[model samples]
Target: MEDVMSLEGPVLKVNGELVLIIPLSAGGDELMKCSRGISEVQGEFLKIVIPEWLAGMLGIEEGDLVCVHNTDGKFHISPSSPRRVH
Candidate 1:
């Protein structure tokens, strides 16, 4: 697996599988490039897209909540339980 751009975002499904959408304004493009991730533009935001292989490693699936940590420009993602803390 390849290193991905890091940021806090959900593990959502784009087509049928899991994908990450990292909201990064600066340095995200370069990071995505270096990490071999796809770049998507959402109006004014630049998002990083990593496929399900990475998600599979983290035991992440679509519809699951996640919190991604940025460690040295790498994606350190962790999935949260279905129960939400209100």
Candidate 2:
């Protein structure tokens, strides 16, 4: 079977600021290469500082829903609007 991973929910905040943080083990080197220029490289993870330019550009707001997708190690995060549950 193929290995696949996915997560859905809201963005996270650290020290009162929103961020997109992922572990190196999650995506390997590919994520680092992809996160360059937009994220800060910490000890074992890449943290993307969000909530201003990024959030505005993507129309993402605090408490907004988000979807996280991992494919072959790489990760993608997208904003989702509130939807009524069935």
Candidate 3:
């Protein structure tokens, strides 16, 4: 699990639809949902929050780094990218 800020506020909207935001480092195997959106925070960070069922389906747990992507009209998840060497 990677470190993430737990935000408590109104749900975020992107282009008029709500979305689940995660760090750019996050990745996943498959997307079980459709139509995700993205937004930036403070011009320097990204964030995400997922439902427990989605997390379980994606095998995501607390502290585990996960990824989400969009294809066509659906969203997918997978393990985060491998660390890059400097």
- Model 1: weakest 10-residue lDDT segment is 27-36
Alpha-carbon lDDT of model 3: 0.42
- Best model number under lDDT: 2
Runs in model 1 lying further than 4 Å from the true structure: 1-8, 22-38, 82-86
> Model 1: per-residue lDDT, tens digit, 1-86?
54444444566777675666654564445445444445565665555555667666666676677765445655455776544448
Per-residue error (Å), model 3, residue 41: 4.2
Per-candidate RMSD, Å: 6.4, 5.0, 13.0
What TM-score would candidate 2 get against the native?
A: 0.55
lDDT of 2 by residue, 45-69 (tens): 7677675776766777667777655
TM-score-sorted candidate list, best first: 2, 1, 3
Per-candidate TM equals 0.51, 0.55, 0.37
Better of 1 and 3 by lDDT: 1
Among these predicted structures, which one has the highest TM-score? 2
| Number of clashes recorded per candidate | 0, 0, 17
